[model samples]
Target: MESSAETELGRRVASFRELGGLSLRALAAAAGVSSSFLSQLENGHTNASVASLRKIAAALGVTPAQLLDDTSVHTRGVLRAADRPSLPLEGAEKYVLSLPPLRNLEVYAGRFEPGGSTGSEAYVHGNSQELFLVTSGEVVFQLAEERYTMRADDSIEFLSSVPHRVLNTSDAPASVVWINSPPTPNESPHAPA
Candidate 1:
């Protein structure tokens, strides 16, 4: 008999994949596992070993704990604002963003102090789509050849593959929520090419 914990883990894993808009075949390809095997695991018809779970977690851009834990609200996988992890970007000053464990789609809450910007130049991430919501103060977003000034309560969604940058245009701090599909590369700013 499958333990409740195991079943919950499987359900969470399945939900995470769905939230990321990944088909079983796509996740299987990324995890180097057979699609049938992934299906079986999702259905709780087979026990998944730790090693297998590790592979799945890596493919999903999450820690195994995020996959196995039953703490999140099952309906929406709500991660409380205080619970997200802070991630620093390269060449950005007075800025920090909460990059939640990517068990599902990537969601981040960013804060930028006055005069802070994402980087000196724009960047393109080919594998994902992005949604940006300005929560407070003001932000200047440069997307490709267009520039937009966003104020509180404004939101924009676009292809992440387009060159984009964010600048805090106010004298006070600015806050924005950024959501992305799939996962961005885990390259460190200081890592050598």
Candidate 2:
């Protein structure tokens, strides 16, 4: 029997895919999944693996957590730390720092373990303005061919459309705060986004 969570995930996936005007085949192609598998997932006949969920979320222009979220419960208010949503990235943990109904801005906090990275392939989102601040330790931001090494209290601003990646090559952990103005639909809801 399908669990409620699985049913809800299927519903959310179908909803988002429809909202994006993507056909089942189109979404499957974009997410690198078989159409039959996606169909089964949408029908709640099966649950997606985390890797599959991540791929689907990326194709849907959202985070895996967003796909699993009961967004009806999200509201604008002072969100307590414990109530904040978190996403585990590759060797890093990302905390969503802003309340839902995000419009003008979105915030995220990332803690990168030593040698952690935001993957080798850089990611690009809509053309929103972005600010990245290194709150603790050190980090390297690779934007296209440009590279910047930032340390504690250091900050940088750039257009979010640039293909970029974040890395902590140091032996110690690193923390960063990222901000985006006029949230974009294509922005990933975790890590440096």
**RMSD in order of candidates:** 5.7, 10.6
Each prediction's whole-model lDDT (CA) = 0.71, 0.83
| Residue pair clashes in candidate 2 | none
Q: Which 10 residues in a row give candidate 1 its minimum summed lDDT?
A: 91-100
Per lDDT, the best of the predicted structures is 2
- Model 1 per-residue lDDT tens digits across residues 6-62: 677778879878755678999989988889989888887776788999999888767
Q: Estimate each model's TM-score.
A: 0.57, 0.58
Q: How many clashes in candidate 2?
A: 0
Model 2 Cα lDDT, one tens digit per residue, 1-193:
9988888889889887775567899899999999999999998889999999999988876778778886822332256878778987778888998644355788888899998887768887788899989999998999889999989999999998999888998999999988988776754665458
Candidate 2 C-alpha error for residue 101, in Å = 0.4
- Judged by whole-model lDDT over C-alpha atoms, candidate 2 comes out at 0.83
Candidate 2 — worst ten consecutive residues by lDDT sum?
A: 70-79
